[model samples]
Target: MTDDRVLPRAVLWDMDGTLLDTEPLWGRAMEEFARGIGAEMTPELRNATMGNSSVDALTKVYEAARVPESGRDFEADEDAMVARVLELFATDLRWRPGALSALDLVAGAEIPMVLVTNTVREVTDVMLETLGRDRFVATVCGDEVAAGKPEPHIYRRAAELVGFCASECLAFEDSPVGAAATHAAGVPAIVIPSAIPVPPKPTYTYRETLEGLTLDDLAAVFAAR
Candidate 1:
């Protein structure tokens, strides 16, 4: 049977909790890093850090821990945090449920994809080993852009790199920060909440999971825009 639904020009994806179940690993590392700095990682701070760049995440940790700015060594703290997260990633990285199948489904349809994440390139590259570098036409990392998620820069750059206008693309996100970025960029997204709950918005299409998603599901989101 011929497919009647129209597909998007390109698909934009979020990393971390959205595609890879790396949020837990990042959290573990953050918690440990916070402890080392004499700070406890609070739930509120952890949620705030979700979908944020390493710099932003670390800053939040410091504030929550009540570490004075005069005592903070941002570069060193960031490096250590990233290093610890990488160690966990090397042994524990895994895909979210049905993420692999969803990826294959999109690839089989020949829809170009761009990975847009607040993850730094160093850590993102390591995760890419499991995600397969060949799947995406372009990968935009936090370090590569002036700002990360919740800022719209990363999403805007990804769409541009993929040769599509933000309006022509459909984004898949799992966090409020990520959703905000996509919305600000004028990209309609299919939001599947992961580590944190994202508020409902008319501009976003919600799904419980990536399982059983079809081109029609994606097309419906794009067509609505």
Candidate 2:
């Protein structure tokens, strides 16, 4: 990403493990789901499924847990996980470091922003309500797309919702799967590692945290792109 000297038309945000410290919440849910399926939540398995969509995560966990991927088990377990997270969200929703401040900075600037997440709407909507129902102009969730992160549909839709193409947007992501989706959407992404460790990737640039992030910082990255 060399200095392209261009400005993004919109900004996109990832929810779980990004704007919110919800990975642990997801972990709790995952553990419950695992136990229900006669599996265990090993660290490796947790890491593997961290940023994935419900189906993808379920499939991976199920495979790793050696659970037969048969019948409606996937959907049933997904609902269980969702239920667990919803219950957690109601009382323990935590914010990621500098998340709200960064959001306020962008919102104050009047740049339209959107929450783009692989999380299903059942959870994302509740998080948005806490973030402030009107904080984002739009939110594109996993359930809205034909495919989730690691696939570009959600990001593409988010960019569209904000009246811009993905190439004209700046996306913030905390997970490699989400980052990959942003990158695939032709959106230059700023990744802030959370819940799961992100291996350094040359395709997308990373920030240490949302703390001290400025619109100028975003433009600098855009310029370099």
In terms of lDDT, the best-performing candidate is 1
The TM-score measured for candidate 2 stands at 0.92
Model 2 Cα lDDT, one tens digit per residue, 24-81 = 8888888878777777888988888888999999888778668664644867677778
Candidate 2 regions with alpha-carbon error over 4 angstroms: 1-6
Q: Estimate each model's TM-score.
A: 0.96, 0.92
Location of the lowest summed lDDT over 10 successive residues in candidate 1: 216-225
Tens digits of per-residue lDDT for model 1 on 1-225? 996787889999898888899999988998898788788788987898888888888888888778888988988878888888888988888899889999999999999999999998888888888899999999999989888888989999999998888988999999999999999999899999997899887779999999999988998886776
Error of 2 at 177 (Å): 0.8
Instruction: RMSD for all candidates, in order, please.
Output: 1.3, 3.1
